[model samples]
Target chain A: MKTVSLAEMKTGQSGRVKKIYGGRGMVARLQALGLYPGKEVTKLSAFFQKGPVVVEIDRSRVAMGYGRASRIFVEVGE
Target chain B: MKMSPKPKRMVLAGNPNVGKSVLFSQLTGARVVISNYPGTTVEFTRGKLQAKGQAWEVLDAPGTYSLEPTCRAEEVAANLVNSADVVVNVIDATNLERNLYLTSQLLERGVPLVIVLNLIDEAAQKGVKLNVPRLQELLGVPVIPTVAISGRGLPELVAALPKAGRGRGEARSPDERWIWIGSVVKQVQRVTRRRRTWLEALELASIQPLTGIPIAALGLYLVFKVIIGCGQWLEGLLENYFFEPFYLPLLQSLSRFLGDGSFWHGLLIGNLPGGQIHLEESMGLLSTGIYAVFGIVLPYLVMFYLVLGFLEDCGYLPRLAVMSDRMMHRLGLHGFAVIPTLLGFGCNVPAVLAARNLESRRERLIVSAMLAVAVPCAAQMSMIIGLVGRRGGAYLGVIIAMLFLIWVAIGLFLDRVLPGYTPSMIVEIPPYRWPSLKAQAQKLGMRLQHFLTEALPFIFGGILLINLLHLVGVIDLLAGAFAPVFRSLLGLPKEAVSTLLVGFLRKDVAVAMLIPLGLTAKQFVVGATVLATYFPCAAAFAVLVKELGVKDMAFVAGIMLTVSTAAGTALNLLLDTVLPAPMLALFLLGLAVVLIAFCGGSSDRRESRKFTLTKERRV
Candidate 1:
């Protein structure tokens, strides 16, 4: 297993969330969207290198800005 | 004698993108727009439903991920849950696990609940199976599987409503709830792996930058072409067939009957400069006013709404937002601002109201002000196309490009000046679906009805007020007072001042007023651009005042006046003396770059610093 920020995950890579590094509000908002630690997520695509990232979590597609995506630490298997 | 019980309140609650709105419309027979995107219902819509011979007040609340509010729209949804005698918790069957989070929250609230497993057909197509009865037994709530769009399973849904009962209301922490939901899902749900569909491939193509950008460009080009080309064709057909042949003769006889020089004649038929009633110049209630609303504006309004409705329903808007996020971030806004901005082109009133989807007050104010100043509603846009489109395509392009520049400039300026952080975009992107023709027609019908009922009267009143002002010399006095400013800065004749004054009431009418003045093409460009930027029409103005509050609206008004004056003068001088079209285009591009570098630099730095701070804190 390898740990990396969600932004660093390649397209189509699936990961389990390890930790979310942000303020309480950001963390809670992500949590409400079912993006808590231990939840499985797949990076679907990103717009540009630094644009919003699209990910699949709990069978739904969510597009979030790059900065927020970077704060999510995920564990992916090699 | 028994008193009838008061109507029971039933609220539809769900995570974003469930078929709650479609279900609401089916139950109440109300024609609310059903879009395949989150935040479509920014405010709750109330409709009446008669079931079992009892009146029910049904509300479609804004969709939220949880009962605990994360944004304004969710706060609205959360509050409505308290008033609901029975809550219909709509769940997207394809996304059961995530949607069940909200369902669990509602269950914890202990409200009378009915679980609607919506989009069942879609889930079945994706090889998903559920044990409905087992699920019902586990949750202790009546569950109904429905395909709301097709109106299938609706009768069963209505029949099950009376069976609503409070679920297990045990409060659970977030982690605990997910764990419990997992167990329930494990027992009652099964998935069969299947090959990916073509629609899935297309959805993937739409989000990737390489194909998505080109697709976006082509899509926008098609939208404009349809709106402008079809709008003009319809306008010409109406003019050639209905207005010119029938309405003109009818009005001519009325002109004769009222006597040529009578006050009634002037008010209804307007002044005949050469014993001829020109529809564009007449300014009469029956002549220019009617033609402006129905003849010129209605065709374009219909086409704009039709196109906008399709975009909203097909689920392309969120992708557009995603594509534009990088550009939007430069203006301290996320891509979500694109939703309200696009709506502004239809009508600034709804667009201003739609700003509620933004997370912060500062973002709302910036977006609303920018919309007011830059985006031209369909009515005004059609008039501009009708008036200046005759000159050439290049002229129209310049005006559009100029407005785009102004929109960006305002966003960049406000991003720097406003003292608040813009919340980043975190939005769900629903898969593209074939828009229902019935739903599109219903949405178009609702918008047209609003235009006819609300805007038609405003247009007529504005014309009447202009005629009254002209009769009493108020217009002339105002014109004389602003003559030098108009002549020197805008290079417009003194008579054009009346149009600007009328603009505050109705911008399309103001643009139509320019037809009589016979200004040169350059003057027409300046006048139309100024009219669009100077103020929101009275209807939009009232909405902005409500949305932004009196103080911020005043600040917006001040910005509008200053920006319009500067833009008008710049257009006048640049087009007249300094540069030709190509050079002016280059100059505008340079100005944009300089503005971005100057105004956007600080905000970019601040954003990076904040991100780094969060990173360091994590370590």
Candidate 2:
């Protein structure tokens, strides 16, 4: 079991949400969009290192900025 | 019958990227800006609706992920929900799990709700379906499945307005609401996964870097070719048939009636260079004014929206926002900033309005200045292309390079000075689908109408003002006043002073006016670039004021004047001696790439490493 921030995921990789940054409020905000712990999110494309990463979660695509995306810890591999 | 002065108010609320704006436009028969991407509608748009013997004033509230506000716009949305009499909660059928989170919040507020399950067509295509009646029963509100973009189920949604009711359950905590929504979705909705289609594959390909960049280049090239080809074809037809047979005769008759060569005739028909009437080139309200709007620019405006509508409806825009994100970050905005910049290519009026989607005041200022200074609207771009394209593609290329360099420079400077904001992109990219024809036509009609009502007046009014200035001899005085700067700074002729001044009113007309000055190719390119970037048109000016406020607009104006003047002067003095246009384009593009890589490349890795170290310590 390997863990990496979403920002570090290569294009076409898949991972499940392991942890999110900040407190209950931040985690709640991420949960509202289905990015809670254990949700499977596939990295569709990670725009360079400084850009937002595009990921597909529960069949919906979302883009998160570098600062936020880097904070979203993910468990890689099925 | 005493008509109550107070109208029944209903606010349409939804999560971002749902079709609330489409539903708003369909019911009210008024157009609102709709983008496939989230956060497109930043402000409330009000329209009146008459249905079911009750007149309701509908407010389209900005989209929110939840009632709990995360950003400034969402705070406005939360307030709207509290004040609204009845809230029409629009939900995306395809993403029920995500959308119902907001619906549950609305339901908890005790506001009467009518759930419009929008984009049901897309949901169906994806093999997802909702039992509308069952959902209505569970939520204790009327649920109507709607294909909003095409106006389908709108009548049913309207009729269900009277059936709006509070849900069976009381308010709960955020965690409880999520669990409750999950149960509701499971009970009433069905999702059956299907094999991927070619469209789905193509959508994926567009996001991946190996394929998307080439596709974007080809797509943009095609868009430009179509706009130019269509505009020129229409221009030739109108000039040959309408101008030669109809418009010229009418102007000639007016010349006789108003006493030809009189002050009135001169004001109405312009100087008529050698007593010849040319519709496209004439400086008159009756001749060139009508010609420029209807003949020269109108065709391309139609084509651009057609292309734009397709791109938006098919959900390619947010993907573009994703792809352009890194580049935009280097320019000091989130990738979503490209959305407004792209819109600026159509017309800066709406583009300025769209800048509201940016996250912060500083972001708004940057995008507005970028649009006004670096990007030329379709009408302005068309004129530049028509004039410069004849000289050489490279000549056009040089002007673009100069503008691009200035655009990057201004962005870098602003990103440094303007502190306290630069939120990273966090966009929801909708899956691509085929655009609906009926919806596309309706959307196109709305944009064209907006352009006509909002922009045409400014163009016509500008010509009238310029004509009055000419009649009063103010033109000569001002031209003389500005000649030294025009000549020494931009290396353009004295007559170009008036041409550039007219840019304040209408840029396309200003560029077209340059043709009569008989400037060389270098002067023409330099003059056109300066006019395009110097200031926004009157229509765009009004919008920038409303969107950014007076203080911010003044700041933006300062930036525009300084950057445009400096760029124009530099281009005039150094362009010929510099590498030819093609090489210059390549050189500037390479320089931009290198600069961005240097600035964004090294600093970010260090910042992220430090960020992670701090997080590790905290953990």
Candidate 3:
């Protein structure tokens, strides 16, 4: 199945970033953060509307944008 | 210069943005060499001074928080503190509690410490009163209340400098320091429940993420308009007054007298068909390069530095960091990254170095890469203003809009791809005050001095190199080889191929080279924007390589090359499809959406992760 929103994924979920939707500045920003696909990610938190969401990928803790989380497609880890 | 017998040495250490520089200047009559710290490129200045008839060497280390060093500046500061005979711990008088933490760390190391209570006047004006003598007694160190900008208490500071020794300074550990600070504050500082004034309200408003970002945008816009407009006006004046009326005629007559066939004539008069220098139109070394440097780049750089120094001295930059923290969080970095971004505006060399303050290597690499690729320094921006803004105000708006979009895109991308813990933001909001004119002027002069001393030589060398290349026919050969790529990939003229070749040496000079071509407004915008984002100047590149290591620097260079070429090529295609007005409007709209989406997504993801962790804990 195709990956769905990060919000829908479980704690051990992983996914490849499919498409980045933004203009020149926006895409460049996303790319800089290492969001481009083919990388594995695991969710660490998901609670309040505006709280810290921790994700581990590339041996580093990455905090994602709220909208970015919603837009992201993740596949659950086996 | 020979020094007197047995010269004294003192190392200056403090939190970033403290008036350590101002204090150092007051103490040292000698010029301080200012640039970013090694490893991380934040600027530091070192100088020599004569105090009590004894010559002393003052090493001003970049701001560090504690002795247990995390960032590059901290490592350097710690090293200096360990080695120096005396450590002058300059503390911002307003943020005594936070500033004292570093002092505590210094005391722990058992260094000879002198606490310069800087910005005392501003603290008092803000209604924060401090009993300096009482505090000094408590800390078991000599505490000098200094209005460093005005040289107040400088004599006392000098007098007490020599008596420095390793003493059991009271605040040796973090807990002990805070406890002592609390007790001392109770005794010396009076806290009144004063209502917020309009200005305080304004200050608070400025730090609110929503309000602050817009304010930052507006501030940037105003700065660009003023600096760019001033540069153009001066350029016209210099052209008409100095070149057209005087230098052109003199050069022409000299060329004729020298009988054009000589090598000096070729070198001096260049390859003009008539072998005469028409200074107004001719791009001669003396006329063009000097005109470009003085008339164009210097004015803008000076003006930009003046405003930047004022903002820095006024203690607004830290507050700006606090305000931008929310947005920075979206990029997997802390608020302090804003410091690098601000420095990047002046020059990326120092900006990339300043990135060392970030908590993790990942954040540093991301910031360094972004700065190199996206941020255009004062010199490059000045040229952009000349080319783009000269067309009309609308074109100027589009270029800015494009830059904003690029910043947002890069930040968002980096946030997701790079793996690093985003440091929790803990910024001290320094008291707002009017910047001292003397201090501002000194800072401006220091920055300009570095630019002139370092960059000017390279600029001249670059010109000479280009001349040699052209004379030896290498330029023609290279231009031909690169012509297909230039036309298809970058949509620039083959002559522009040479400009690109020289761009790595000095961006301002490269852009100036394009002036002779008389490209249309759209072409100018595309070319300038791409160049601004393409590659950092040679100095900045060297700093990046040193700070980030050769492997990472190579990676960053690859990214910059690819992005700039692709963006420039894409822009050329898009320009043909859309009319100027609609294209600009669409671009701005797209940029806003991108920024919002990027910011919103990262924050939301962070929140969601936190939520699950809390839920797991409850379970």
Candidate 4:
């Protein structure tokens, strides 16, 4: 298992959320959208290198800004 | 004898982008605009529903992911659930696990609940099947599977409403709730591998930058072509077929009956210059006012709303939002800002209302201010075209380009100056669906109805007010007062002052007023561009004042006044000397470079500091 920020995850890579590095509000907001720790997520696409990232979580696609995406740590299998 | 019981308050709550709105419309038969993206319904809509002789007040609340509100729209949803006698928790069947999170929250609230599994057909197509009876047993609530768009399962839904009962009301922490949800899903849901659909491929293509950018360009081009081309065609048809042939003769006879010089005649038919009534130049309430509203504005409004409705329903708007995220970030906004900006093109009133979707006050203020100053609604755009398009297409192009530059400049300037950093966008991109013709038509109908009822009277009153001011000599007094600014700064004739004064009331009417001035091409471009930038029209002004509060509205007004004057003066100076085309291009490019460099450098430092501050707060 390798840990990386969500922003570093390659497209189509699936990962288990390890930790979220942000304020309590940010973590709660993500949790509400079903992006809590231990949940699985797949990087669907990134618009550009530094643009927002799109990820699929529980069969729904969510687009997160680059900064927010960078704060999410996920564990990926090699 | 018994007192009638108060109507039960039924609130529809759910995760964003589910079919709550569709279900609300079906249940109440109230046609509110339903779109494919989240935050489409920013405010709750109330409608009356009578089922089995029991009166119910049905409210379609703004969609939210949880009862713990994250933004303004979510706060509205959270507040609404409290008053709901029975809450219908709509869940997207295809996204059961994510949706159930909200359902669990609702369950914890212990409100009378009915679980609606919507989009069942789409889930089936994706090889997801639910044992609804088992799901109901596990959740301890009545569950109804529904296809909201098709109106299937609606009867059963209504029948099950009376059976709604509070589920297990045990309060659970976020982690505990997820564990419970997992157990429930494991028992009642099945997912089998299936072939990816073409729509899935298209969805992937639309978010990848290489294809998405080109697709975005083509999509926007088509939208504009449809709006402008079809709008003009309809306008011509209305004028040539209906207004010119039938309405003019009747008005002329009325002019004769009222005795051409009478007060009522002037008020209704306007001045007969050379014994002819000019629809565009006539300032009468009935002549120019009716022609402006129905003849010119209505056609364009219809087309704009139709295309906008299509974009909203087909789920292309969210994709557009995602594509524009990078560009928007430069302006201190996220992708969601595009929604209000696009709505501003149709009308600023709804645009101001739509700004509620943004998470911060600073973002809302910036959008509102920029919209007021730079964006011209369809009505004004049509009039501008009529006023300037005849000069040359290039002249109109210059005016549009100038507005775009101003829009960007205002965005950048506000981002740097505003106190807080823009909240990052965390939005869901719903899969593109085939837009329903019925829903599109309904949305179009609602917008047209709003326009006719709200705007038609304002136009007539403005014309009457203008005519009254002209008769009372107030117009000449105001014109004399502002004449120096028009003559010196704008290079417009003294008579053009009246149009600017009328501009505050209605932009289209003000541009139409420019018709009789017969200004030079340069003056025409300056006048049209200045009119668009000067201020929001009366209808839009009212909405802005309500949305932005008094102080921010004043600030926005100040920006409008300053920007319009600067734009007018710059255009006049540039156009008067007729600089070479390449020189003009170079000058504009230089200005853009300077503006970007000045704003970008400081903002980048401020943004990093903000991130660190947030991190400290978290610790």
Candidate 5:
């Protein structure tokens, strides 16, 4: 399946990040944080109205802008 | 810069951060000279003095605690102290007792000593009065009270030097010296108890277990927030306005000319496997590596050093040490571990060496291990925060939680595995005085200059080496060779296999390589964790080899490699099968509970009362 919005991410779940939707230099940064395809990630928390989504993958934790998180699709499972 | 023939040598020795370099600068003027010591790469500064119609060469040795050095700088100071004809023991009079510990050690060594009671004015203003002449008589050395910054007491210090040199020709027992100090103080020194200041009360409150830890946590929280905020702000400016607007286009144009297939093209731009201009993965000189170091790491390190320098100059470090002593003991370290840990925030090499001051071999080993395992040096942290924290603030918390847990857990495990008595911390907490903005700025400038000149070159060279390897297909070979380890053991991609191969050379450069391959969140987390916990940098490895010898260094390296891979693999699989959100969070909460249970029970037991505070007075 193609990547889904990070906002659509389910709590207590796992998925792969398809893309970072927005932020001036965020796409580059998202890549730097290991937010590429074919990698497993678990959603930890989403904050506020349209706030960032926190996720854990590979023993490292990262947060992404909700707008960007939304642009990315994840094949969720478990 | 020319030295006079038969230049009489003078050496400056003092506790770290006591303004010795400032004194050295003032004494020598701007035309002072500096050189490496005879047999060591460590540099020593020498300035010519024309006092008493005799030309004397003054050397500003690095600071140390005692004659026995626990760090490289201290070792250099000890060597200088032994070689010099006249030794100036520059003491910070504010913390008289702890400073005197070093003075006492120097006195035992029988070095020709002239005591520069630096910060005396501050001491007196704070109601600490010293009988200078009585101290001189007691210690059998010349004592002068001068604020080194204002150039006070230089003439008196010069006049008394000849006499002090003669005094050191005779050796005396440390007990005799202590008795002498007692007699001298009895004759001349008088301390009138002043009304307790708010700072004094705060100091007392800060060291008490009930209050101190929360204060420390708050302090750390504030510092981290400020540091992270400043880092992100500066990184935004550099990455967007500075590099993207101007530098990247220029480099991109230059890459076009290099024709992508030429030797310099691949060497400079890195091999764009599909010939795509990968800004993050450009093995080229002008692409990923340069941008990584200059754009990403530089701004953060600059800000970090400034904040740390301000903290150091204000003398809050010693207070923090005292406040954290109890928790540090639980972690199998003394409060002094705070110093090395603080240093590790700047660079791990000195932090590892600074571990020597710990009371036991076990403490040193544990501290050293933790520093290597959990604490990312300024360079690495800059990249991590710049790259990961940018994803979201939550990611910053995640990174912090992961490392903090590792720091605490590894410390606890080592404490259990290695049984040794930890030295009690009786550090003198200097009053919370205002830091001199000018001095702080100057010191910060010097450290930044040192970091740029000495360290940045190594960063570039490491990148260049990786570029060469990528060009020669060596990186691929190594990655393929380690594919089983990465795929099976760590569950990371084969492309990530190369970054880990490069991490040992320099961590920031390795992390920089990640910008190109563009892994998802999972790959990034795994890659960052493995790199952070892996072996020390190339320079640090060399120092460790020298300090620990090849055999012991190998042992440490083996443990680190095994633990790093296992931790990464376990974390990956745990997240996969059983360790979900509540499970991992619950596990962490449970661990904290177990820790509190174990630690509280031990300290609450009857044996704790054996060393109650009433036995000896608190400082």
Candidate 6:
């Protein structure tokens, strides 16, 4: 498994959340919304550079901007 | 059973888009918006259920992921759960792990609870199955599995309602709670991993830039076309059949009965030249008052709500929210704030009410200000189109473009200067489903009923008050006092002052009142601009007061006065020879450059975050 920023992941690629690299407040918020270590999240769509990225996790689609997505580290299983 | 103890106050609690509303409607027989998008309710809704010889009060609060209360809507949800006797916690069966976080919070509240595992149909399709009996035994609550829209398992849900148990809410660490949830899910849930379904594929294609942008544009264009086309067709029918024949003759007869030029006649029928009642110009309670509300505004109000209701019920709104996130970021708002902005064009009252979906008090203030100051509702727009479109489309374009710039500018200013931070949006967009026709019609009818019963009184009462003031010569005195400002500042004649005053009551009527002014194209542009920017209608004003409280309303009022005066005067001076549209557009472009340069104050966001953190610490 190779870990990369969620922002760097291509659309349709699936990964398990490995680490969140952000402020305490933002990290807590993302965690409350179901993005935590070991949970699988698949990228639905990532628009142009710096735009919001859409991801699907456990049957819900969540939208996160690049700034926040970059701080989230995800491991894609090979 | 001692009258069943007033049937127990049952509040349906859940993360947004988990079918709380659908279940609420099924239980209470009250239709509500069931869009898969989060925050469609924005505020809680109450309905009564009479079954099993007990009267039960059912509430459907705005959806929240957890009990921590991030935004105003979540705060509402969290606060509501505190007062309920039995909380019906709706868990999405397919996503049990994520949804259980909120269920765990509800359990900790020590309330008697009924666990509703909703959307079972969708869950089954996704290859997920739950052992409901085992789940119930573990959670120590009565569990009911339901497919809300289809009414599956609803009878069993009612049968199990009386078995709710009050939890001890034993205080435990969040880690322990998570572990407990994981254990429960592992024991009760079976997940079969499978390939993507067609619905999932559609959801994927909806957010990509290349496809999503064009789809959004096409969808929005269709929505507007249907509203405008249906509204105009209804307007034509009302004018020919109802107004010209029935309402007009009755008004003219009332004019003759009171006798033209008499005080009673003038008060009731207004100043009708040649003793004929002019519905639009008469400015009386029975004349323009009823005419404006029922004839002009009602059709557009109905059509807009109907189309909007369909869009909202089918879950198109969240997709729109996703596509607009980048633009919303530049304006310093969460992407979800776009719903209220879209509703603003339909009507400002519901739009202001919808602003509560935003996270902070600062955001609520900014959204309301944006609506009252810049956006024109569809009713107001129709009249503006009727009057302004006659001159040339360019004049009307200038007004709209100017308002859009003001909206962005004010957002930038408030986002910087306000002493709080907007939470970053993490909107949960559910998969789209076909809307039910009966539910859509019921929702649309309910909103239309609200408009007529609530808004018409204010419109008629305002026109009546204006008529009384005019009869008493109070309007003349005020208009005389403000005539200089009205003439030089706004480039309008003094008589137009009354129209501007009536603007505060209803902008639709305000624009209609401008018809008798006979002003130049430039002056009409200035007058309409000031009318829109100065203040919202009486109905919108009351809603803002309720939503923002009196103190914030006063602050918003002060800003409205200052900024509207500046915008109106600026337009008047600039529209001397050439069109002011291009010049104002250029100026706004420069302002955008400056706003982008500073990023609308990065330091301010950090400072506000600190302030909010301190407040939270104190709490």
Assess candidate 4 and give its TM-score to the true structure.
0.96
For the record, the alpha-carbon RMSD of candidate 2 to the native fold, in angstroms, is 2.8
Question: Chain A structural similarity (TM-score) per candidate?
Answer: 0.95, 0.89, 0.68, 0.96, 0.76, 0.93
**Poorly placed runs, candidate 3 (over 4 Å):** A1-78, B1-4, B31-44, B169-173, B191-198, B209-214, B259-262, B273-281, B396-398, B581-592, B595-611
Q: By descending lDDT, how would the candidates be arranged?
A: 1, 4, 2, 6, 3, 5
Instruction: Give the Å error, residue A19, model 1.
Output: 0.9
TM-score-better candidate, 5 vs 6:
6
Instruction: Give the winner by DockQ.
Output: 4
Query: After superposition, which runs of candidate 6 have C-alpha atoms over 4 Å from their true positions?
Result: A21-25, B5-7, B30-34, B108-110, B166-172, B191-199, B419-421, B549-552, B580-619
Candidate 6 local Cα displacement, residue B475, angstroms? 1.3
Listed in order, the DockQ scores are 0.73, 0.65, 0.03, 0.79, 0.01, 0.53
Ordered by TM-score, highest first, the candidates read: 1, 4, 2, 6, 3, 5
**lDDT of each residue in B379-419, candidate 5, tens digit only:** 88898887866655444444455666677767776666654
What lDDT does candidate 5 reach at residue B393? 49
Error of 4 at B217 (Å): 0.9
* B1-619: candidate 1 lDDT, tens digit per residue: 4433898899999998898899999999998978988888989999998777667899999999888787789899999999999999999999888888888888888999999999999899988899999999999999999999889988898888889989777899989988988899999999998998999888888898888889899999999999999999999999999998999999999998998889988888998867888888988999998999999999989999999999999999999999988888888788899999999999999898888988789889989988999999989999999888888776676677678778888888888887766767799989888999999989999999988898878888889998889879998899999999999999999999999878988999999999889888888999998999998898999999998999999999999999999989989988747876656766776777677556663465577788887678667
Q: What is the per-residue lDDT of model 2 for residues A58-78, given as tens digits with 9 covering 90 to 100? A: 778888777878888999974
Give the residue spans of candidate 1 off by over 4 A. Answer: B1-3, B582-590, B593-601
For A1-78, candidate 6 gives per-residue lDDT tens digits of 898878899888999999876556566567667888878999988878467788888767789765567668899977
Q: Superposing every Cα of model 3 onto the true structure, what RMSD results?
A: 10.4
Tens digits of per-residue lDDT for model 2 on B1-619?
A: 4555678899999998888888898889877767666777878899999875688999999888888876666777889988877899999999998898888878777898888999898899899978888888888888899988778999898888878898655778766877787788889888898999998998888887778878888888997788778767876787788877888898878866876567767667766777777675667777777777877777777878888888877888887887777777777777788888888888887677777766677788888888888998888876787678779888888877777777777777777677554656567878776776777777798888877886677787778877777768888998899889888998988877787668888888888888778788888878888998888887788889888889988988998888888878877876666656677667877776777766643323444566778698767
Error of 3 at B163 (Å): 3.3
Each prediction's TM-score versus the true structure: 0.97, 0.92, 0.80, 0.96, 0.75, 0.90
The top-ranked prediction according to lDDT is 1
Model 4: residues with Cα > 4 Å off, grouped in runs: B1-4, B580-598, B601-604, B610-619
